[model samples]
Target: MKLLFCVYLSVLFFSLFSCQNDKRVENENSLSIQREKSKLVVEYRILSNVKYLEDRNCIEKLASCKNPKAEVRFLFPKNISELGLDTAYQEDSYFIHQLGVFNKPIFNEDENYRIYVMTFDYMVSLVVFEDKRTKNRTFTITGKAKGIFWINSSYWIVGNDCHMGCSMSIERIKDPKLLKPTKEQNLDSLRKQLQRLPYEEKMKIVRQEGDELLFSANDTLYNGIGKKLSGFIPYQNSMILVFEQYKSNKYRFIQVNEDKSVEHIDSLVNGKFDTRQFSEDDMITILPKNQSLISLCQTIFKIENDTLFVYSLR
Candidate 1:
């Protein structure tokens, strides 16, 4: 009788513990971080039945198949429009590299326009979009682009002018005409000035030392995160880092502010955690006031599953 009672109590405790663990996992899977005042919402949209041209399997198929072009269709999620994507979007190349890998989209201060420096085989294209609509693609420029930034109510493009003995050109494009460069100037003085910008400064400090992560903001040096620092991005006055805790086998997203305060943004288990997905390369558009949206595409070529992750923070 007593033995039976002990066994029953043990079983009940185990069930309750399991239930709690399951609930925690479910919360993490939902990708919504509920804080006291604000909520961070994450949406994962799958682009199914497609593979990149450079993918191992796709390359194998290209070698064996007679047809040079693979008839691949990218099926985006229904809610992609909300994530600032056009459902009827068309690309010149079927290569995934041309789509989203190297091109880092930048948003204007008003958040109305999203600009992309798309690289083609021959030349690079400067594409802009207003909301979910294609605003214009006529701003395409030649030569390799270093970076594009929005500074002082205009878009600044920095690129190498190999035609001019490998010198760099800093071109500015203002409103009315999105990217009609007024003039090309030497890059030495301007490069230093641009680095002093708050956004640029914050990006410089998020680095890794050996296996430990380090971030310095406003003279406060933050270190000792975990084995690997997956990625980080500057948000307002804070920098958010995705850290992989090898000992616990978990991933944590931590926000460190200029005031030396730290906040826990989110966490995920190692198995389901996405690494090398959050960085400056990902698109980030700041909404009108107090809210921002970040989008990243994750592709698994083996499974031919591509997902676009949109994270909304308020």
Candidate 2:
């Protein structure tokens, strides 16, 4: 009787252990599947219906579209005075009046920077400066869509009477590889992780409080038009709110602590003070106005080993 009882207990113990192991494995697999599905969904949503224009390939494709309404027309080709327009056209010698879906060379020589045309349902636009300065010059072409919508048709109308005679062309090229969202994605992930933590724990990292003194001031510091807060960089126990106080000038950095207090860091005289990042030995700041700085306008911020690095946006 004793031996039978011992055997029964051992079998029951093994059975329970096996079931627990199976449950653990199933849960892990479920989590893994969920993560993969989330990633695929985000990638598809971000990249769908997006086309890239590189080199001079799309120019011919744009010009060959048979859509009569989508035709590229040069509205004013004779002279600027004849058009009687009141828009600022800087660089009068080499200005583009109007462009449709056709691609063309923007600068004097092909310094790897090429412009492409894109048309949407509501507007026809151009994606210019795709070559070397791809990030900075990737601007949207916004205007009313005139003609037909056909498969692979890009068209643009040129403005007549411009300094340089307007022209349009197209070519075929492969799409650019999917670009990983480096900083933005990482920052969003960090914020999500931080938000998951308990409220008390999050407060320990960064506290939020209002400053009535700063809000009440009506001085030039806050009086400039188009002044708005853009973003911030949070460091060890502090955060910096980047703002555009003036429409023409670069962004200004205002540092804030965990207690919600804020202060302005002095602008660097010769050095540009665009973005702020903390370093063990010293803090690295990016300034846009520095003429000697090579990528003055295109800087990215990254953190490594608790040290922050600032990159210019040129």
Candidate 3:
């Protein structure tokens, strides 16, 4: 009877502890959700559709078309027009895709700054555009880079070099003038360390060590969501990761907060959309002014027949 009483007491103690732990986790999750909901008050609106057509003379694809021509009828918001895009813009030699998507515009966290990749045959350059509302300045980085990421308040470039296989470099404002290039002393060691990190997806650096190395944010995101990560958008202190369901047309937009809490933001069902073709930055445009108001715009493009239709989701 004494041994039975001891076992019963032990079971009671374990059950109580387990319930308390469960409540703690539940409270934490509830707090995270409340915090997220307060800040992420997104207002959705649909803008007018803009259309573009392929040139009748060009026989090849738009990428190869040297003289790509399209009748451009762009209708954008006033803030987008503030970026110096003329609403009545018409194309003679270059199409809309050639200027925007083809060139590749990589936007930073706040969207105040952007880097445009300019490729001319064998030569490639990065054009950095800084918008201060009053004064807009542009600078150029003359080189080829496999990938460029705005990591830890600095632009890290994975340079493509055939000599040493490849190299890494950092560009930051040194004297408050312009972005200056800084070379790492130990390239081989840094490369080796980065290679050792267990990265399941490409270019999604979720983890970071010191000032240079970066790793995946969450391992569970890789295994739980899908085998492939479409892309991610960095918003404030959280990251909105996109993943397509396996063997399905559905896409999941997941938000991972700073406290490591995961939440599902939204989902999209489109058969023609493929994340592999474009980066998240390319697909979505977040303006700085609208972000402060908790009102931002998302643009989605669809091509039917030979005409391109651009839809704005605000």
- By TM-score, the best candidate is 3
Estimate candidate 3's alpha-carbon lDDT, on a 0 to 1 scale. 0.33
lDDT of 3 by residue, 24-136 (tens): 23322321342343133222223433221222121113443354432221223334444333433311211122333234343333344543333211112333445445234
Q: Scored by CA lDDT, what does every candidate get?
A: 0.32, 0.25, 0.33
Which should have the higher lDDT, number 1 or number 3? 3
**Over 4 Å off, model 3:** 1-209, 212-223, 259-261, 266-275, 279-314
lDDT of 2 by residue, 1-314 (tens): 99786565344322221222321233112212211111100000011121211221111222335553232221112222222322232122121212332323222213343333332211122223244554333222222111111112221211101011111111111221111111222322433454365535433321121101011111223333114333333334433334445444455544433322444543311222332211100111111111111111112233334433443321
RMSD to truth, every model: 20.3, 26.4, 17.3
- How big is the RMSD of model 2? 26.4
Better of 1 and 2 by TM-score: 1
RMSD of 3: 17.3
Candidate number achieving the greatest lDDT relative to the actual structure: 3
Error of 2 at 63 (Å): 27
What's the C-alpha lDDT at position 305 in model 2?
Answer: 46
Q: Which ten residues in a row have the lowest lDDT in candidate 1?
A: 206-215
Q: What clash pairs does model 1 have?
A: none
